[model samples]
Target chain A: MSAQDLDGGSDAETDGSGEMPKPHTIRLELVDEPGQLLAALKPISDNGGNLLSIFHERGSLTPRGHIPVEVDLECPPDRFERIVEALREAGVNVIRAGAEHFGEEVMVILVGDIVDSDLSDTLHRIESSADATLQDLSLSAREGTDEASSARLRLAVRSGRVDETLSVVRDLAAEKGLHVVEPLAEGSQ
Target chain B: MSLRLAVLGAGAVGGSVLDLAGDYGHDVVAFADSSSSAVDPAGLDPSAVHDRKERDGVVGEAAPEAVFDADYDVLVEATPTTLGDAEPGFSHVERALADDRHVVLANKGPVAERYADLRALEAESEGTVQFEAAVGGAIPVLSTISDLGAPHVTAARGVLNGTANFILSRMAAEGLDYEHVLAEAQDLGVAEADPTFDVDGIDAALKFVILANVLSDGETEYALDDAEVEGIRNVPGTALDLAAEDGRTVRLIGEATADGVRVAPRLIPQGSALSVTGTQNIVQLETKHAGQLNISGRGAGGPETATAVLSDVSRLE
Candidate 1:
């Protein structure tokens, strides 16, 4: 449970812990700043996690004008929770967590004046309220703010949690006067 | 007629080089990889090559020293691109060239990231590094440009990354999201385990650097940060829908003009070479005399990229 227990073992080999560390993929939203990625990585290292790789989408933009970062790391089960907590404490917006956690992915389209509807807030709400992670998103505004625009969202949710996510999405759409086009069910094929 | 060659880093591209060289009756001096245990001095047994075939024999042990001691005419660099580390794969190339061995490179990291330094080294040693396989796999973009009188390329752009294009194509065609399409690409092995290079525009940027170097009349270096890069990761499905509505398609384009060079995902009109469907790569070069020249073909994969290396070797001879 202590920090020393985590880094004591060699990177290639495991420490005295009986359990092997599991690999977890964490997606984060980071503001564009010098050493932002390194800043985000400090928590992972502090909690005894070994980095596998970093997928920093530099050109990518989130609602908060931040970059999307995807990190894969390996840590013991006990330290995994601490890593997450440390990341949160460090003010990192942990967008998604764990590899097996994102079991089902769904794509939904929303057609409306997305820009006028406070799109950023809407996306933040959907992610939090639906218990879903926004894996990817695309938006098209042909005529600018006054005209109709559509945004496509790729959401990853816990298995069997699609209904709740969809419900929240529907509620958000209704509130913002947007039309939601959901994909076909998994069993439809 | 036997060309003795040693390839450093037997990854997807390197393995293909070995296969093609072996097919053409070339004497493969040795296969050196990151793991030393995997070094095969008599050239890898054809079947042993087949066993580690998935990664193109890149995963096994690498023998960094074998490259220096091996008696080979050519060294092919197939290692990954490491930023700030000038000696990614071509460090082996440097050693081989220092030993007066020619180098054929499929790895762009060294060339794009360290063009000046490597070029200086190549000049000092008076050795040649032919990289016909660097820019466009089997497209002959580099050879064509060089042979076609080094046309005054005013502007250049293309759908560089096959994996990104494949993902975009699926997204446009099936209305699938990025994750679904990317997963499909990964399952098909068209993408790297760490797809950052492909998705984040580094791969395309590397190609642009090569193009700039080959096309430029003067010696100039393009900084990685200078290029305008936009990956398809943030490209929403709605953009594709819009493009579909507008009779256009989205393609990640790396373009250079007289004024500046830019690389980003842009929506181009459908039926254009850049918007060509599938995993094919299409490059449109605007030269002073030739006007607009379009070259299209398979960008990457074992067979296609291997053929590119063979073309370089043939040119060297």
Candidate 2:
């Protein structure tokens, strides 16, 4: 199944006893150092989380050269939170804990010197700014950094925080000298 | 699947359990009430025992102590709700869990007020405790939360006390005062003659305390005393009318967050999930992933609660 389906649709899936064990996807940014994967999975299992699958993007690296791993696990909802807490307690970098719950999808077009402004840093800042995460992005900088090129950023925000998240994006774009085309307030101008 | 059960408190819930256990492949081996009890290694006939209680006003030849020594795989405690010290019921659960027998409780007393003690008892025994009926009657509220796990269920809010809700609903719907509605509730058997427990918010507080404890996975123990309780006694019909004028109605709400538990009459906007009317109960769980999940149903009744107790028994396997 797709990752989104597993996260949001687990309540409909039940074991033989008619009780649904929640499926959670924990996104971790692991250091390239050895034993990082083992270190991450240990906390989940120790806390009674049933591991479903682990997608270790070994070849890929974050801007910090850390490997991004997505560990899908099945547990009661309470244990899922504890497992996330436990992973954090174990000093694992949790990039995203419960991504599926972010229901509000807002796409904003940033028009400016997109590539010159350190796009990765911008994305990281936005992810850390609020209860929002970068779901997908289409950055087109073929016209070069000196000229104004636009990037389409799709953000998955926590439900009901769309307005707040859009404001954060607005402020961020204004500070970065980027013009924003917000999906929500398209009528304003 | 001939599961042996020792049932404590042959009241409404307990009696319904005995009546229904056979349908679920369970048999009541031992049964007890306040005055008397009956025990048999071979399962006791529920009809015979019930008849004895009706015909002779006592449960056969055995005494209440016989339940503790009875041979059973599971203990179902459907005792009356008790408050301070959570006596008799607490002791019964302790004995069962300490004896390595699984416990399914309809009694809210021990689970709400003495959770830590019960946890200690559970840890020392080979049994685990399940009390789905304690919180929301037949709603499967606790089981739903338990299944969702605490990580997803961030908060639990509900209209828990039926008598209080009934009184409030009538107070708002018919413009009757609390005393008048309460009297109607009493006449209809919805409110007890001594409705102090249900009307004072004690019962709802107990349920919320239990929910808080369950959400915390027993790490954070909460007692009824820990809850901030406000009953419906002080709620005037005029206040409800004023709220309705503003498109709102009041519900006796019990809420439990990580911070604490509280039971008080609160204004619910019209058509909101919390604005549930009548004697119905609604438990809304705010989840991290699943959004808000609401379960509403008849929150109290012998047969309804017995269904939860039976489900807990089946869950033991």
Candidate 3:
């Protein structure tokens, strides 16, 4: 399809009377199977969503072993929810429906050998495993003792999935012999 | 109504029970340490008995087993909590029930490890078992559950250990590491010489386990092994720093529900009701009708736990 044809394919959007198309970010978890990425993208374009970027993290598998895909698209404000619904109906795992509905925010602390355990790898695994976004992290590895290292992670997890995200963090911590101090007040604010 | 009492053990709790029983309109007919016993058909003088114990290290002239011979109305079991079979303490409660006498307990072992067995014993005997002091000392956790109706109470969560709470709060307030704050807590007499039990989460876990047994209503019996316990020993000062930055703090919180029991060092909002500081403790009961009931106070010490034991004696009336 030509760029001009793609731009003018829908005349309803060409009219200036309707609401302007706004950019929305939807995070997805796609299986590593062939054509899975294409299958996930079809619903977006089919629903009149203008695709702007497809950030497919091919090698970084979530703890569940699924590839993380980030899609940035522009659509009318009302069509965003419907696009996500179509993705779900067509068997695509949507981690974040949009940037506005960011779900629950949880803070967890890891005590013991954090840097030695490969923090980036641990972060990647947890984000993929729990489908979370690491908003911020504070690490304290005292200059002396090898055992006194710790890092506190701030993550924004999908709605109602705080427990599931915690379970994944625990799994990774267990493997690395790192102690996890989980948040008790998950949805309590 | 005044009741005759037989106090067991020579620990702080038992001594407090002996010293304060009269004020609560109760008479101590028998008092026993692990190896010795003091018995009188009439009420015993607590001051004289305590003086003898302080000077001679023995409370009485009789054998410890002779406490059963006293004509007492309630057996106040204030022995140290032991795991596994919860022996001696369990045997004492069993013998008291077998004799058709009510038992008030401060020891956690019998209730946490052998809830079903204790309930079964209470069923077969003429007396019922009440163990208010075995959980949050002076907090009336079990009595509150009984008042709320066990079926109506959905869950119980709290910071059940004083020593652990003291260390965590001190670390947060001072930005001190775990070892540093723990040493200070030990010097302050907040934590015991062998801090393993309290800091390792066993003490908290046991309390929640007992809560589970009581809240489950005999459908499921829980012991220390059934709990998923994690201690505060591994909590570094940096961890607390991170929490403080987020307007939160770390606490060793234990939760008991119909599902089960768990105790761990968890992050909680600093100003939340469950975020009790120093040696203070709190129990949050999630009730079906009342929402969340937050009960906070001194969770341990002879005087504090004595109130709970005496309250149990009053309940038997």
Candidate 4:
């Protein structure tokens, strides 16, 4: 799957300077063959994830007879997800990934020709740029897009970034000639 | 008052949950058996569904994947346990969490094998995963530890698998051999036809790994292989007799800590806490401040296990 398909770039980017690396851990199940550990590690290193530790339970086995290995690494949140996808693509069984929690919620409404204007792209952009995930959505196209349409979206965002998420939605709506209904009820425009 | 639900298995556990969910105020919107699946966005008729599945041997009209796209608040994974890769059960969880739906697991494969991956999926989505039925059947051992808090839980050890415990107990009590007791247990339906997973200690070890992960705050998780396992296949009745004469009994014990996990036969003095017999299960938690806590009850049953699955579903807000 492409970068957009996995999480739609919903993770926060740590590309800027002075950003501390996020500590991420991935537990993987590996086949009992030589170089399996190396093959799994390659994805993390290749994807710019700095390795912190590796714990390969060579003595133990999962129910499927594969060895379980835990890798601790540090990278920006988005890079972490890429490493996970890469590991999965390489046929490594990622038993677990990031320990970070997405704990904030925000609700917003978009009005105007939402259906005709590629709402999917707008949703993807908001997720990618605002570090938010779509929780629940209710779209009202009762009168059809030729006249007017609106969508209510419930989003789970990274903690303390509700305003940043709303602003991203506002910008997307402005570009699409859509009106906004803010979660805080700052008066729909 | 009514919460939407999608059930992934129509077997014993699934059937019981389907029957009891109404009492808990949950509407069964979708359901699936091994051979087929059915879904209704407006909520399915329970009696009609039961009649169809019992008489016609089918539940829903669509494939299992269709349930993911259907409207539901939580997905109850009640499929058969698939160890190693944790298949169809894992896939079901993947799709549900990806769709941002809460998950309640009755299948042991996903939670025991792919806990970390499931947690990652839960973190990314607007959902959470719970699997009280995975271990100790209806015992509620996992939740008990969680309620007491994990930090206070330094170690969790128990007789997790009922089949193994039952076989060992019979051998020790009757002074019978392992094969003889195992054959009898199989006849009684306590042991499966191929009891390697249970007799070989893999089943108990899986539960050990899960508890180890939970106690360590999901930091240190051991695989089934990581556990130092020794099944009761070769254990002699004389060993049990020997321990019995000394006021001790031999039991299959699984212990987990931050350092490691192991499942093997251990000698516990008779009348002591760990010497549970029959098909009963026990989980003893070694706490740092709250003292040691031991919870024991019926470990595995269709109705008993369903209660855990239902409890998990109710936990989802």
TM-score of each: 0.61, 0.63, 0.82, 0.61
To one decimal, what is the Cα RMSD in angstroms of model 2 from the true structure? 20.0
Best by the DockQ measure: 3
For TM-score, candidate 2 versus 3, the one ahead is: 3
Q: Which stretches of candidate 2 lie over 4 Å from their true place?
A: A1-189
lDDT of 4 by residue, A46-122 (tens): 99999988888999999999999877677865677789999999999998764433245566656667667776677
Tens digits of lDDT, candidate 2, B1-317 = 67889998888999999899889998898999888899988788988998999999999687888888888999998888888789888988888877889998899999998999988899899999999989889998988887888777888887888889899888889977777788899999999999999898999999999999989886789998889887877566555655565566667788898879978776566677767777899888889887788888999998999999999999886
Which 10 successive residues of model 1 chain B have the least lDDT summed? B53-62
Give DockQ: model 2.
Answer: 0.01
> Sorted on TM-score, highest at the top, how do the candidates line up?
3, 2, 1, 4
The alpha-carbon RMSD over the true interface for every model, in angstroms, is 13.1, 23.3, 2.2, 31.5
Report the lDDT tens digits of candidate 3 across residue range A17-99. Answer: 35666556789999889999999999999998999888899979899999998887878777878899999999999998755
- Residue-level lDDT tens digits of model 1 in B86-199: 465657778877888888888887777777777888887856988878888889888777766655666667778888888888889997777778888899887867788888
Per-residue lDDT tens digits for candidate 1, residues A1-189, read 221233343332222244555556788999888988999999999889999888899997998898998887777667888898999999999988754553576667676777678766677788768866665556775442233567767676755688889889989999988766554331111
Better of 1 and 3 by TM-score: 3
Instruction: List, residue by residue over B1-317, the lDDT tens digit for candidate 3.
Output: 99999999889999999989999999999999998999988899988999988899999899998999889999999999999899989999999999999999999999999998999999999988999999999998888899899999999999999999999998889877778888888889888889999999999999999999989988899999999999988998878877887898899999997769999999998898888898999999998887888888989999889999999999899
A best-first ranking of the candidates according to their DockQ comes to 3, 1, 2, 4
Residue B83 Cα positional deviation in candidate 2, in Å, after optimal superposition: 1.9
Error of 3 at B189 (Å): 1.6
Score candidate 2 by lDDT.
Answer: 0.79
Candidate 2, clashing residue pairs? A77-B148, A77-B149, A77-B151, A78-B149, A78-B150, A78-B151
List candidate 4 segments past 4 Å from native.
A1-189
Candidate 2 A-chain TM-score: 0.45
